[model samples]
Target: MPLPDPWNRDSLVWRIPLAGGAAESDDNPGVDPPEAWVRALAAVALDLRCLRYGREVNVGRLVWDLAVDSEYFVSIGWQGARGVGGFSRGEGLTVDASFGEAAVWVADTVQSELAGYDFVQWPSRGRHLLLPRLLATNPAWVDPHGGRR
Candidate 1:
């Protein structure tokens, strides 16, 4: 299994691993990455549909369902696409915070998870002050990324 510490981006840019894949090996016990990817793709389709048209985006099991060994833990009764879900396997980091605080910390955590994120730029780039950024800038309709923004 991949080591867990690599996912934490406390300081610099982060990278979500788009690793190649696992071949059909006798040693492999679980679902292959390709299959997992396909399943994830399908899941995204459902989420998008529900997110747009459904009455609610009620996620019952964040860690077990949406977040796969998601590795993020924060205190919240409700979570949309935003905010931390549950703990990832490696270094279990527990944070008790409001939405804004979690937003700040989670940005670092997920920015670490993204494919190419500059964490070093954080100290200077106002990432440390992201909680307000999340609350202030979050549009009811548009998401953070420019696609929605």
Candidate 2:
């Protein structure tokens, strides 16, 4: 039988192979990138001051449901390698985050950090995507194409 639907108000569903790899394979049954991704995400959660873990959740299960304030609940998971996560605020808001690559970091808000860059809607989700700059104003990201601003 097909696997049961895993999406709900409390869970995030992920696709596989990240860019192109599997969590498991028939010949090599032990390769699991999702597990590693989960570990990285959990470490990020621990370092984030904006998020607080509920009594039921600890470091071991940070990949599972997490309480985000009184009205919001968040969950993260992966099917193969494509990681998925989100932030939900009661019935009013639900932001789905998708990563083309699994190298992701979670923060309370990126508004301050991405200020002044042109942003676009990220797919159908309510979230915004920061546009890449031809000439990065920050000294650390100088563009080689001679478009410095």
Every candidate's CA RMSD: 15.1, 14.7
For 26-113, candidate 1 gives per-residue lDDT tens digits of 2223533233322332333232232222123222333221122234332111122333333332233333233343334443443233
* TM accuracy, model 1: 0.22
The digit string of per-residue lDDT tens for model 2 on 29-120 reads 44332443444344344433322222222222222322222223233332211222223222222233222111132221221222322341
Native RMSD of candidate 1 (Å): 15.1
**Candidate 1, 89: how far from true, in Å?**
7.7
lDDT of each: 0.29, 0.28
TM-score of each: 0.22, 0.22
Q: Which 10-residue window of candidate 1 scores lowest in summed lDDT? A: 11-20
Off by more than 4 A, model 2:
1-28, 34-39, 48-75, 78-149
The global Cα lDDT (0 to 1) of model 2 is 0.28
